[model samples]
Target: MKRKAPSNPVTQTQKQLSLEDDKVKALFNQKIWDPKFQDELKDEIANAKPYNWGTIHDLVDDDLLRAVRKEIETEIHFTKKETDIYKVNQSGDLANLSGLDWNDLSRLPNMYKLRQILYSEKYRDFFGYVTGAGKLSASKTDMSVNTYTKGCHLLTHDDVIGSRRISFILYLPDPDRKWKSHYGGGLRLFPSIKENIPYTDPCAKLVPQFNQIAFFKVQPGFSFHDVEEVRVDKHRLSIQGWYHIPQKGEDGYIPGEEEAWIDQNISTLAQLESRTLQDFEFPNAEREILPFHQTKHYERLLTGEEDNNKDCKFLSEALKLTEREIQYLSQYISPEHLTAEGITKLQKSFEDNSSLQIESFLNDPKSDLLKKLIKHDELNKECPMEAKDVKAPWKTATPSHKWRYLYMDGKSHEYFATEEDMLENLNNEEPSNFKWLKETLINAKTSNNDNELEIALVDLAQFLKSLIFKKYIATLTLLCPLAEKVIIRRFRPGKDFTLATKCNLSEVLKGVEGFVDAVLEATLCLTPSNGWTSGEVGGYELYMADETIDEEEKDDTQYERDVEDATVYRRDDAGDSVLINKPASWNSLNLVLRDESVMEFVKYISWGAESSRWDVRIQWDVKSMESDV
Candidate 1:
């Protein structure tokens, strides 16, 4: 008989590397397997406030974890990434183990062992039992390492995507030291105002220590959370992973279960786009159509009908501010921006780039007074930190997942608790009027009181709403405005932001004459303090191309899943997609004509910021002036 073929050395080594049951058990804290301890954890998870979640300290073997950290520090490469939602140093997914051979595994033996044992049947069962997430798939290993140094953060979002069953994070900060609450990298959870709306503030927070594991079942609408920005210069290292639903051949596998689950739970992006939820959102993406009379006025001006000079050649000449108009505007706007030459230059620049940044946009007297008032308020006054505490004329933008900031829309504060309430408010809404605002501005200019900041901001908002200012904008952009909204906004330090979102155009304007299918957006930045030049403390406004493919054309399941999980799509820094990244500044103006294909967001302000980012944000429903000209 031929001698038996010698067993392959590599095959034998692979078999040896397959973690034994007893060895895997030894890699974790012994309490994990104790029946009493397991029951206690289950009870704790069930009783947790805000949401069902649990944590275990010293979950992994100390020596093994230390070795794993050592391997990671030596072998792993991290890239610093900044997006609207987060800024962190990240390594490639740790789930690439299936592609590695024994040689690669040998180099990271401890890491390999940790991944194996964590996903091993024994530990997964314990995890499933405590969190009540049911069966988890061992075949789907999803994990990545992240280091959040100073200024890094992950904003508010619910982890609801694909077949994920549970979310977890294992801390690996310096083992010898304690991670204090003040360090500001805690995992904070928010209570839901209703099924799909999270409260503006977090109700619970978990500050993780080395060798600790925090986890919770993935509750689509209810489980909203965020990572507080790291305030100090220290590396807060952690491994974030997810346990997905069972796959075919697994014990709890059920055909179409994942599909059913996905159908039942809509992603955050889908929720944001839901037509039914629009009314629930404050500062809704709705523009009041310019009254017919106002629209006709602008149209005639553009057509030179106002001057009865149909022979006018350039758009700048047709829409130019008269000397009298310029003198009136000189009270608020910079004189330099009102000159004939200035208007021509602005129109040329805007025509070439479809964007412009005008510095010293406000006249010096107004700018200086406003800056002094804002800076004084920042240094002395106490800002309202809760939604209920926000004073009238200043309302907090709500439905936390989409955006949160203080805005003055010159309307009485109203909170809609139901659909009926929203409908009533809409039906009763009156046409725009600036009589009260004009009177308030007069009183504010002469008043010597603490409300000067509010008064000044309101005065600017009123000025922006004026037809004269609209004419100035028309000249600069060569676009006639059909409708508009002017909002005085304050992005509070450590609390406020607007997430990445695209312009929501009204269906009524779809086929209207001269419609350009774009929004003429402008932000007059009036941040008061210094030290924001680097954008390290957040408060930067970013505009990017909406690179999402049309749903009907997508064929890749993984790409579809990533799109559902909005964070994953935005996590990578795709330099080419970014159109603008303007940091918080003083007395500057940014104008971008945005279409449906562009998305924009204001980065979350860090607690380290010297003051809030104050600005007058304006949007105009614009139409082409070519036909009128």
Candidate 2:
């Protein structure tokens, strides 16, 4: 008994692993730990511009990695998940690596060994030294394997989830083939506008290669990144993980610091979300109230006293209605909003805050007809999922991550997917505006566009373009001084939405300045049915206060422009929203006075929607007289 002695379990396990797998011997390049290499790598990372990041090629043992990949491909089950921000296939969190039965270990032997090596104290020290992230917890290993195939993507986000100190991804694409940038699924890093608000485009990109590792310290607001949509038919497999701060009882553990970091990180999201809504969404509450002085000014206009004294023609001039025009308008507009008292109430609301919602906007007869047509088109017409197949005067909105819909802009005669095609179409047209609707409809009515496939939808678009409809819009918004851009939009179930975005001062309309601070926008929703009352199926219109900071604030050197900086307004109610969440409704008109910072969007229509969210969207770059008068 004394001769055998007690077998050392840990030593026996290591011996068994060494005997079974020679591939594990080359898991990490030993040169990474050499004194000279470590010093150089630290310097390179510390001095890196834009952001601190590093990449290593041939980071893993080839045979072992290939075996892990094979095991994943064959044994792992993936679920496809989609959101407004991302669409990707993901496997369950690799919890099995931590606790495996004998049979499971036998099957996933390579994966088990890989996990052991990655979390080992030796590798932890190396990673900690290189990233300068301090002590990483061996106990808290968070990792998941993902396969991004065609059309898979992830929109911009900073990986600042709780306790995450460093973020890394190890690529396992085809070892024999080169993964090119054109094939698309590259990791893109975005530059910040101030802090937390990332620019629309990426400033840096990393096209991953097989057996390569990419990593960076997880900075809350600064580490914005995304995976570009996979354009070609191929698989991009990778293991994504985070190294967290050491927990209590672990080496280098600091008391109360992790909690403080998590609290600060969570607060960043809360602060940004509020500011984001205000800067980009609609119906800004901060400026929603009509000042008493503006109300008095508006009252003078309504009472006809201001017009007599100052030659200020308000609704009368805005409407520009002759007897013939009134007759045509009467066909579409309900009598409720046509009266003097009704006009006064609307004027007061509009003058006060520049926003109004008129229920029963259209006359009963017209509403009934329009609703029937929309329902019939939705039920009968074949909706194209691909942007190219969409017909025009309707064109499919491209770069689906931002917005996707069949929109009748009344400019393009055919579908245009690329920005170049859209710009060309705009330039070729006589007027670079949606006022082209009238002309487009006239042409469509007279000549048969042989390529046009969906006739019913075209007819519906023609209705939205009719002079009668425009007159009704003019009566409500009083935005007739400026040229209008009208669009009939159809957000198909499951595939359509507009991401939150603010209205910009269009370069085309820069010369038409001296207007109001806010842009006038309106939407007439006609969903045909009552199913959208709850907003459960999406298609709700959302608006929030503007989040833009003062120009001087940005220039302030002392202002901390990081996620931790709570420079803007901070409240417990940061994420609380003020919205005009009218789900798809028949004959409901929503008009908004939107500043450039006010964000707005039609939420994505879920597959569960009863039908499409049909709307006649309108915009005007109006100059508010109140600004000067």
Candidate 3:
């Protein structure tokens, strides 16, 4: 059943005013770039546990935001995802959506301006700087505006789509006071204990204030941010945007610079990441067959009107072979004769053994889906996973992959592999990462009639996912229905451990737990062969009383010696030795491990923050004053 959106996200002038008042006057004049705010930003960024979310208080320009909002209300068309409502305006897809000719920008002036502004070099530079992305290509930007309504809030998601280097949102609320806390429509930032799994409680909140912006690097696991429910009657006005690889010579980006960047960042587990692959569509309209189409073609074109077995493409081909070899050809090549072992997974197609109908497109394996994938493989093109791909990418799919595809469309999820499995695979590298296991299972899947195929597929997914986490004692993965690269991580105890690769952690963790007496061996990858040049360096000492005072460097601003049992450590590279009261916090961490794999996995774990926000959060307060009633 199609779901209904919970609430509207469109913010009006009147309601937006209610979100803020003169009471938060301090917050209004709050410096967007002040040091104190920076600390809070850092704290929110570091302590950002998974599932917690954050939104920009002022991520983008207010005038442009208002312009976009006007366009969305006046000219844009919207649709539904179960119950959620969305309005999209992509430059390239404008023709399709508006059914207008794309010859001139003057025709759609506002959309043209939006496209121009988003792709402007100025915007690109600002985006790249804020994201610490260096220089970005203007052509990569696919800017759009999204309007949400009752139940319109997007569920837990990572905006790490294909080739999107960074993702951001610019909130447009009232010109007056702030967007208050109680009305609910606040943006939340989550911290990661591990990928995919989010912790409760927000790392930071934007109380629906006007003209604010929030942004983060599209770190799949860590950048797990979300929109709050629009509790009352209101709509949120926001501009969604991305920064892409510099186009050609736009930023002096060489042809392979983007790929090289990805290669330098990705993890092996990402290599096995599932992606938005095309589904299958019946090709009854075509005369030719498909590439994966194992069915044999007729010797000479059968032009006659009344041919028997016209229902089956394989039978028609067999009719031309003469009667002597008809039965033999039918045994292997005909759909009827495709003993559950043929190219197509007939068993999955006929689970009930009642209705048996193969998609006609398989008759033309050279159909759109296969052909497009082949072209992509050849060009090494990283197709945009933007929702816009739906306009052109899914038309030629067949019934088999289509069945799987539909599940993705409706559910936006798929089961995939994890980093921990890959870490284990790296440890067991004689066989090269479940290659044989996956092949055997796929082979078993050929006989779809066997229920074991589903189980085998699941096993294959898990095996592929494990390659993501190298340090975790355990790890888990969840692919968005059709989106394969955006895998979420769920670390299982002992299966995985994440050292902040973004931050130099060699300075910390010494005395905390493992490093009290001697040096600690952390599992973070730092091999020259693995792209990281910084080698392993760690040390720690148990929490102890300060005995010797460095009179030369006696600074009053040092940490208070509140407790004597805190662990302290000087890391070889990960910064200074600070006392840590909580060692268990280091025991488990949330971040994707990097590798030379799918690049998506690399992005999934990469760090994206204005500054680090580190903290040891205690969810439940210990009531030392009162006992259990």
Query: What does candidate 1 score on TM?
Result: 0.90
In TM-score terms, candidate 2 sits at 0.53
Candidate 1 vs candidate 3: the TM-score winner is: 1
In the range 98-154, model 1's lDDT, one tens digit per residue, is 334666677888887888898889899999999988789977766677888988888
lDDT of 3 by residue, 342-439 (tens): 42343233333211223221113212332343333324533222222322112111111111010111111111122223223322322112334444
Q: Poorest 10 consecutive residues of model 3 by lDDT?
A: 617-626
Q: What is the C-alpha RMSD of each candidate to the true structure, in Å?
A: 5.6, 12.9, 27.3
Clashes of each: 0, 14, 117
lDDT scores in order: 0.79, 0.63, 0.32
Misplaced by over 4 Å in model 2 are: 1-25, 93-103, 267-272, 276-629
Residue 524, candidate 3: how far off, in angstroms? 44
Order of the predicted models by TM-score, top scorer first: 1, 2, 3
List ranges where model 3 is wrong by over 4 Å: 1-64, 83-111, 173-185, 195-202, 252-257, 260-629
488 in model 1: Cα distance from truth in Å?
A: 0.9
Best candidate according to lDDT: 1
Instruction: Give the Å error, residue 289, model 3.
Output: 43
